[model samples]
Target: MNAMTTLTYFFPRRVLRAVVVLLSCVCLAASAAESEAAEQPNIIFILADDLGYGDLSCYGQKNFKTPNLDRMAKEGMRFTQHYAGCTVCAPSRACLLSGQHTGHVHQRANGPIEFRPDPQDISIGRLLKNAGYHTAMIGKSGLACNSQNGNHPAEKGFDHFFGYISHGAAHRYYPQVLWRDGEKVQYPDNHGKEGKHYSTDMFVADAKEYIKEHKDGPFFLHLSLQAPHADLNVPAKWRDPFVGKFKEKPHTKDSHYRNETHPKATFAGMVTNLDDAVGQILDELKEQGIDENTIVMFASDNGPMSEGGWDRNFFNSGGPLKGGKRDMYEGGVRVPMIAWQPGKIAAGETSDHVSAFWDFVPTACEAAGIKPPADTDGLSYLPTLYGKGEQPEHDYLYWEFHERGGKQAVRQGDWKAVRLDFQTDPSRPLELYNLADDLAETKNVAAEHPEIVARMREIMRKAHVDTELFKIPAN
Candidate 1:
């Protein structure tokens, strides 16, 4: 202080003023840098319903055409060993949105857990909203969290909401009514065959409008798209592209090329329509010049059900992984995941660091320079997204889905244990696989590793509280 005062006296008033101004500018720059580092990335989390790990062209499914998704994959990082927390929609959505595992939310399979938590339980959308982000939920939503007024998107921190609460409305490409921020935004009262609307188109339109409106500010869009899910009804404008295909159910087809069959071709059409929607959103982002600042994450709710999906012997739904949809197998849990950020994330990068559904909540928070709420099961993958981290996100992954009805599985490091509910009588046999060696889960090593099974059982025991039903069912 003495030296500074002496220098100020010697330099006179103008010098002192200049020095003060320069120092202030430096401080301001430092503050701005800190803010810039903490600045949010406009996030667009696109989730496809019942979309398989191998469904997209980027994921190596030769049968289906997912050009938009493939393009997005090429622009960013792709994870080969990503998984869904639950095998079905309701629980999976609950886990992903809450940043906790299904156990924490007491949501398992389609309806194992009931009752939505109070709106303050800290969901991703809510966190973003708390951080002053313009949030929206643009598609399928089914959660047992604050949905008494049925958890409409805005109440959950989504400023804009479009789409349906039921998984059925999403299952259809067109519906009679869609919810817009807790209100029933319906379509034509009666469809007389003139000016018929498609659901995919409607979702895309809403997504585009949202983007067009919010590109200037930091925004988060949960574009939960329902495609390749079920019902097998696609409009002619979308379906006309694929007239020949295969069956959704168990049917036999002997065609070297998948397009020749009825079901496969129909499935291809569904995928194409979904891809078109993806293109539309991306285009909107580009048109608005927010493509570079935006970080978009794409994934499916779960693996294909092996029913009403790209169901064919040739179409390896999980593609080299064993199990489909409900089982605690690779095919069922592991699905394709892509993260794209222009000029930030490396293009065409691939990682196998064991990511999961819960990771997104924290990851998005990190991107926004916000901290995750306490009691979250997820860890941020922001460092990994920028290709900086080496350690895997989680050392162990657990699954308790009723999809296999009564299946319990746990994965620690490279080892995994899977026990079917009714394999025998009341006691089902546990099957263990070293996923490092057997991605297909073709061999069971549980008999050889009793100690590991005991240790895993202990892990499950400690994690029991998360699985307990936190709230009773409605009615």
Candidate 2:
């Protein structure tokens, strides 16, 4: 006899009816759950390594045009005052993932440092995964120093992870081996100096595949592309287009990165290649019919680097900002940020919201209709995106870098203060600037504004909590 016949025969009519009703309710609840999961929006965060704020044409690049990114800006909202977590890679990513600023984040510097988060600390991947979303991190994940330990991407709540586990490994454009979840996948063709495969292209392919596989429901894909970072290498197809577009000056120096024949052309090509990859991911989302249900955010990890023979001044990579890369100035920390979601975020909108990378976690949580962690240092700018509700503002933003003799910066209203050599001398004098009047931060008005300087110094002192690994001397 069938299971249903057996059940009916073993029970009374009322009991059998109750059994049927219970089964029906269970099925209905499951169906409702599946529907809810499908209804939640997909999130794709694309991070470009070492891409400058003004690298894209939309952000005032006169050297090369980023048509796809420009199109993305026109179709979505562009943020003019978005800042990265820090001036470097590892710490910056740590702050972004942990939803905390550099002041209280683990892995404050790049090196052979262990990424040991607090027991209560929740990563962005974990935050989304707990909400019934499939999470995937494709491309460079510079947080972990050891992949086998608890610091691995898998352990950090990513359901699927593919790419370099360390920052040093990510410097190469043609990597010999890449991590697939917890396994190391080898590429024999890319074993030597020259290779048939490019790392960024592989990352894009994997990202596209992940989107296709998870097209039905809620998913969070962190697509981190290592491009325009170093080596100044790209296939002829991407580099050839900009070969003769600019004045020629070959880079033949032997440094950390390989020398380039035409540094400017190759750099421009790398950016354009990055732009193309973004376009492909967008196209894939549209083809899967999830464009309206997916929100794509594009931003660089930090500012541009002068490494790998790439010319920052030739391309004006930092735009009107004061310094590039390593510095604590606007050019180093401020980066280009774009958000695209059809029928959700308004089109052709530009917001001067002073948001930072740490805010991503809360903003994404709010977008997915979930609550962010209570200990998070970031505030969601969801209201600004939808042009509804009263958007919250930050009282101040803080950043501290361990490298380059230690740097600390604080931004409050129109005033900005920077302190150098803080690790050695915590009571160092701060260089103050009125950003409202001098956006470039060319002048130091610390002597003129003593009270403001005192207030900023107090903030810097209180914001930083000394850690065992990266400690700032007590004031």
Candidate 3:
């Protein structure tokens, strides 16, 4: 051996050996951490209640500006052909979480009142939890009303939940008590009138806390904000700006809930407040150093509401789409959706890749490297998100409503077919609209295209399996 090598061999050989082993272990630990981080990404899905397709400035809302949402669109991918599950709340949320269409989803309508997802049901939360991720739902979880009755968010795979359980309770922004996990936590300050405590404020705080707590996380967060819905009430600070801007019509008071004298201003304020929440969530992700590895999504539950003195036509909330909530039109189902990831999803992109609430399940599964349940109607849009591979197209998309004389709609390629009053009269003539030609859905060309109408009718018939609660009446 050389003179230096012989000197090193004589100088603490056991100490040198231990030092080399320690270095190897340190490198291995770092490699394991990097691998875990790469395998799992944080997911944040923010669902706005009763927000219309054109409610955001980015989506063409001219009356009020939504700067944050517009910025989000500029920083992310905006979806022009994205749709909500249904025209209502509970069913729409169910479709989103369960990854099932209205036909197959458990909650078909707003009521069989106090509807909750079955314990054994396959939900996005459960799927993610099974894949070893922390899951939480904050804000208006209209899925289950009474936690004591047992169909709580906890049962549906959320480790933590804080929000209004009942759909009706959600209508009132300030409530006496809200559900926290499995218990009802009282907010005595929030009485009948506008109190110091605001549900939206609470939700935002909770969401931020959750993110901070799970920063070193593979976490799934569903931030369901009850904004711009009905009972058009907002905090004075948010509502003050829009007051007296638009031509006024005082909203007549209702017994069920408080009414706003300046409904127009209040509505705009509520939406802007929601926009602020979105901005805050994005900021939190960035601050937590997880923005690059997190996929942030924003979407509405359904179309704008016509109730609580809110005017859909005045604001052009549906944009060029025909009809509002409850109608089987583009306005009711089609809503703005934005997906943001710094490097993963291409920035300043727009995707017309037709997708809906059900599609989210497979998309989330693909992102998390988890296998989605076999029975899901959803197909993953991860390819579109990643902007890499070929994205598979859906044969058709379908939706059915139990209320409003019963309505069903199907979209096959560029053609849309609607069967209105289906339960009342199963033989009613179908309305066919070539969405490619008429985005407004003004003209019905059933007489011009009999063959397409027939195919649409058949698809509607097969799309839905007979459910006792949402059944086609026997004539």
Please list the C-alpha lDDT of all candidates, in the order they appear: 0.73, 0.87, 0.87
Which 10 successive residues of model 1 have the least lDDT summed? Answer: 466-475
List the RMSD of every prediction in angstroms: 6.7, 2.6, 4.6
Query: What ordering of candidates by TM-score runs from best to worst?
Result: 2, 3, 1
Candidate 3 local lDDT, 338-426, one digit each (tens): 99999889889999999999999999998888788888999999899998788999999999999878999999999999988877787
- Write one digit per residue (lDDT tens) for candidate 1, span 1-475: 6987888777987888899999999999999866764466789998888778878888888865788888888888998878887777887887788887755665665642333445555678889888768988887774542243534566667788887777644555557777787888767842311236777778889889888888776888999887777655566666666554544343334232122235665677777888888888888888899898899888888888655434524476677887677767877778889988889999989987787888888888888877888888887888888877654458677766554336667778898887675322335556889988988898888889999977876665555453344321111
Off by over 4 Å in 3: 1-37, 112-119, 145-151, 473-475
Cand. 3 TM to true fold: 0.91
Candidate 3 has its poorest 10 consecutive residues by lDDT at 142-151
**lDDT over C-alpha atoms for residue 328 of model 3:** 83
Q: Between prediction 1 and prediction 3, which has the larger lDDT?
A: 3
Error of 2 at 118 (Å): 7.8
Candidate 2 residues 149-173, lDDT tens each? 4237777789999998877778888
Which one is best on lDDT? Answer: 2
- True lDDT of residue 215, candidate 2: 94
